[model samples]
Target: MKIEILLDIKNRLGEGPLWDAESERLYWIDSLGCVAYRCTHDGREIRAWDLPDAIGSMAIRKDGNGAVVALRRGFHFLDFRTGDVDLIVDPEPDKPNNRLNDGKVDRRGRFIAGSMDTSEEGKNSGLYRLDPDLTLHKLDDGIIVSNGPCWSPDSKTFYFTDSWSGEIWAYDYDLETGNVSNRRTFTRLDTSTGGAADGSTVDAEGFVWNAQVYDGKLIRYAPDGTVDRVINMPVKKITSVMFGGPNLDVLYVTSMAIRHLPRFPHDPVERGALFAVRDLGVRGVPESRFGA
Candidate 1:
């Protein structure tokens, strides 16, 4: 199926794009602009919320009510109806150079996110999990550009990426204990290519769909570590991807137009647009909003 350009956000740095099944809306973040956007299927109405800091990613609650957001300072609960934000946790209070990057909620409704250096040049970041009880645990360390915290459909395997390392790693996940082990290289990007792996999501078949930043493409990988398919995009930097729509057939991808090259020309229109491709038939899990 062909991918369609749903929204032209002209975002300077578009990062996370998620689909809320209950509301039938698409939510995404513009990391540099510190803005969150919501769009419907018909594309008639668009709503946006301004964040105090860069918002890396967000997930809707299990009850289909609100959302939980990963911010530069920490995580927070966002009331969709009123736009009220409440702090959840601050992972790196001492390191002002780092901030939350990409994140997703697991099958158990736990928010797992990672951190990255603000300059995008150091390995001082790590992956973290926020449990239901609000306790924060450091899952993995020594990550530079922390991306993808996606799990398999059965929740037995986890896939993560460290962009600077140009590699995507998979681990045997223990859902009961929230422990990850058996780390092994799943895929490696050719540095000669324009980009590396960014955010990713798993399909029902356990295949991983990863957004290749600076490459302007989304790659679908088979469990055996073979490149199954590549969906090309109009923009150069593809930050993230998620399955949305009621049937989960729509594949939504977020792209950024940042000038990663030392002497690259800028295209005003393609820099931060939200693009969508249809007929993939992949549905995504909802974001978990906290409840009393």
Candidate 2:
């Protein structure tokens, strides 16, 4: 297929585009701007909220109340009605250089998030899971930039990325026990041309659609580690992707304008933008919300 530029906010660092099925709105975050935004399917009705700190990612609540947010300092609850914020847990209070990055609620409503080092690169970061009861568990360690963290349609497999390593890994997931095993390489990037995989989402057919940062494209991959399709993009740094629209035929993508500063200086069109492509007709499972 073909990709179209739907909304070009010129976002400094736009990430985490989640489709709110009940409201028919797309929610995303501008990490550097520390703002969360909501818009319609056609890219209208823009609404934004200023967060106290940089927001890594967010998820809708099970009861349709508000959202559980992973912020730079810690995790909190965002009230959709009153706009009230409540802190849940802070995993890295001592490591000031580290900040929360990408996160999502599993099938069981447990929020799993990853952290990245804001200072130096390399594997100084780790992945943590926030249970429904608000307890935190360290799932993996020695990661530099943690991204993706999306689950398969059956909830029996998890796909996550380590951007620094340029590798996407799959883990055998135990839905009941919330445990992951059998860590193996799913895919690796060609560092010469493609940027590392950032955020990703799985479709109903078990294909993983990932946003290839610096590559200016979105890739669909089969379960056995094969490239299914690639949709070219205008911008270099694509941050994330999600399947949305009425029948989920439309795919919404978020991109970053961070690393293209000096080279493409003064070029305004390619910054933080929301993109859309049609005809996939793949429905994504509703995002899990946090609640009792």
Candidate 3:
């Protein structure tokens, strides 16, 4: 694929990229930076804000003027016009060691995200679902590090990954009632070929494109969990990726820089940088809104 540096922010933990079809802009977060940013696809007209906590993932509001944010504390409303934040709830207020991670808006508009223990003890992290009505439900737990919650093109299948483990799970998703069942191991990585799976996205053709945490490669998996394609990256700490661009044909990837500073001091081209790959010619559906 044709890859090029799109944004050179070089964040410590860059993840959770989303495309706003209404505003025609792309949004992402720098976890360690505790910041969320919005910028054009061409890497111009940038605007950013520092949140009170590390922002893991965010979904654009249906109203088009705000975002549903998965902050360290919990879910909140971030108003872009006024810089206002309204707390919805802190699902695990007592668990100071855990924080929200990768998140997505379901087909029905509920926000689904997962949390992981910062201590890496892997004791009490879990997957959570927040209904548009503001009710929080624990879907699963005992996770080490949670990442990636993308749906199939038809929105009938849900895919998730626990970065600590080298496996991805799939579920039969019910869009009407916001229910998931039939959990099965969709695929397990060898870890020798790639590191853990960090983030992923589904395409128009139902293929799952996942990023390798420390292996510097992005892989495309067919619906049956067979590997189809691989795109090698220039950085080892690739965190997350999303399909953006006006036509959703450009694949935007986020990487980590601080962890690789000691190994790639001379990395002037692509270490921890936001990259764009445009040769695949695949398109993605618009990100679902925060609420119905």
Best by lDDT: 3
Count of backbone collisions in candidate 1: 10
The Cα local distance difference test for each model comes to 0.80, 0.83, 0.86
Runs of candidate 3 exceeding 4 Å displacement: 260-269
lDDT of 2 by residue, 1-292 (tens): 6678888787778999998777788899998888888888888899887888988999888777788888998898888777788898889888888989999888788888999987527678889988888888999989988999889889988999888687899999888877788999998877677467899998888899999887777889898768998877777778898888766668889877666334322324766788888766566776766653
Off by over 4 Å in 1: 260-268, 281-292
Tell me how far the alpha carbon of residue 218 in candidate 3 is from the true structure, in angstroms, after superposition. Answer: 0.3
lDDT of 1: 0.80
Which lDDT value does model 2 have at 217? 71
RMSD of 1: 2.1
Worst 10 residues of 1 by lDDT: 283-292
Instruction: Report the lDDT tens digits of candidate 1 across residue range 160-219.
Output: 998888889999988787888999999887668657889898887878899987777788
How much lDDT does candidate 3 score? 0.86
lDDT for predicted candidate 2 compared with the true structure: 0.83
lDDT of 3 by residue, 101-202 (tens): 899998788999999887655658989999988899888888878898999988899999888677999999988877788989989887975478988999
Kindly give the number of clashing pairs for every candidate. 10, 1, 0
Ranked by lDDT from best down, the candidates are 3, 2, 1
